[model samples]
Target: MTTSSSSPTVDHAPRDPADGRWTPRLVLILIALAWPTQLLAAGGILGANAIAGVAQAFHTTQVVWFGLTLTLVSTLLTPFVIKLGDLYGKRRVMLAMTALGALGELLAALAGSFWLVLAGRAIAGFYGPFGALSFAAVRDVFPARLVKQASGVMGSSVGLVAIVSPFLAGWLIDTWGYRGVLWFLAAATAVAFALIALLVPETPRHAFGSRLDWPGGLVLGGGLTAVVYALGQGQS
Candidate 1:
């Protein structure tokens, strides 16, 4: 009569492993990694197709400023973004970049002046570190054994987007005005942001307290800026 009744053990169910695996969600995340760049490339190229329209809208032949601002600002911000991603979480930085890119696209689409468009393009620079940040994210989320395959998939997606951007740009330009390209980019970025939010888990980071060499960063940034400026000038 002295024996105490033991409490029943409640068996908890294990979480689903497939949800965290690399089969589909990871693949989609990799593709989405290139979303911002793909949209930027398509919109920049569309500017050439709609040069006359752009000039008419801005009342200036300096419409090239839009593309240049988009590209250059992003380039200049890459080091900052890389360091931020390393210090914080890559996923958080990536989401911020996508959101900024979306805001930039919307601003460009509704722009009433060339300067506003330039501002929008500059805002879009947040997307500059996407590829690098995404690669780091893949490494954080996936196992070492799967990283190679994941990287290969992400790399190939860049080529695939390049191949398809021309056609996509042409179709959008033909169907809608150049402004529509900005709208399309905004929409695409929104979708990508949603995908990332829902599908991609928070990536593990080992970068806490890691020091950044400011002097080296500045030197590298200066050198890269000069080279990029030259390339942009060549295009003009």
Candidate 2:
């Protein structure tokens, strides 16, 4: 009798040696991811708390634009940034965005006019989707058994930041004024950049074959901006 021969199967997925245990590297990676997630959550709180100081400094009632610009830009860019992370490597894209965010924070801190501060906030919005990126990175790099735990830690970080940021913002606003708040954010984002750069690994899988739908993104962003702008105006 003749026997048929079959080719051996190969598993190509990325592997970690410490798949089943909590390793130091894993903890560092979690911290790297969670810190930026915290910063992103904290930004809204800090902005809201510091609005009066911003108005006083610039002597303009249009301080509303500080929050509005950030919200609008974040709404517009989050999808594009996420798609870019999928197409390119998540770590690389995340670093670039975080660096841009730090620069924006610095700009806002030093800006002499309200318009420049709004422009800075618009730039800083590039960092808005960082938490989503961190979650995707966890999926990409963590072992199957560790993903649930890692995700739980990431989700909990937001709650932690929410509880702490209001108090932190209030103190900063009291001590150094609104610019101090921006300075603090810039420093925190820079630390996040360093952590991610040093510890987080790039995702092995990428959707290089996929194409970005720019037209759809533009239409959606424009519609959302219009609606949000109208609502914001209505509130005033």
Candidate 3:
């Protein structure tokens, strides 16, 4: 008997099939993540719709800077934002980004100077990573089998917002001007923050003990900024 001893086997199968199935909680998480993603995607159209008003308010013809600043800042910030989420926590970074985005929107809404408005747009660019982070968060939280479906849901939000945001932005700009558009963004971001706080759970998987490659990030950001700037200048 002593010579025939063996280690006991362990069962690796899922305890319950329902554990990974679609549920109300997962649905809520999807909604919470999708809300901010749609808002982030809507920024470009909103800015375009309100450009004339913004240029007149600022008394400048260089209305391109409004969109340009946002695009550049977002391009620069997205990599860092994604890394931070991986190192620390997705939910934590998302809440901070949403809050900052709302603050940026408010600043733009209340700003009286052209420079201040640009600054606000730069800050709001933090929202750029919302879609990427939301997708990652969905992957982290949803069961493997359901990831594709969840991703589809998240991807659809952008298209849906695109269809509606132009009409909404036109209405807001017509009724209340560019500042009103900023105010609407601030309000929407606030709602997103609340929903995320209430419904979205923190992801368990994190690249803990891993460090962000700051030097690489800086190099990449600089290169991207240069390329984007050149493209914009070429277009102009």
Candidate 2 deviant stretches above 4 angstroms: 1-14
Q: After superposition, how far is residue 44 of candidate 1 from its true place, in Å?
A: 4.6
Candidate 2 colliding pairs: none
Tens-digit lDDT track of model 3 for 34-129: 888878778778888888999988899777888888788878877888888777778889999999889988998999899999899889878767
Q: Which residue pairs does candidate 3 place in steric collision?
A: none
**Candidate 1 C-alpha lDDT tens digits along 111-171:** 8888887888788767655776777777766766777887777666666666777787778
The global C-alpha lDDT for each of the candidates, from Candidate 1 onward, is 0.70, 0.85, 0.82
Give lDDT: candidate 3, residue 178. 94
Q: For model 1, what is the error of residue 215's alpha carbon versus the real structure, in angstroms, after optimal superposition? A: 4.9
Score residue 154 of candidate 1 by CA lDDT.
65
What is the Å distance of residue 74 in model 3 from its true position? Answer: 0.9
**RMSD (Cα, Å) of model 3:** 5.7
Against the true structure, candidate 1 reaches a TM-score of 0.81
Q: How do all models score by TM-score?
A: 0.81, 0.90, 0.89
Which candidate has the top score in TM-score? 2
**Cα lDDT tens digits for candidate 2, 1-236:** 99753422122224579777888888888899889987888988998999999989889978788988887887777777778787777888899989989999999999988889998998898888787688888888788899999999889778888999999999999999999899999999999999999998877436665789898878887788788788778875
Off by over 4 Å in 1: 1-25, 31-52, 211-216
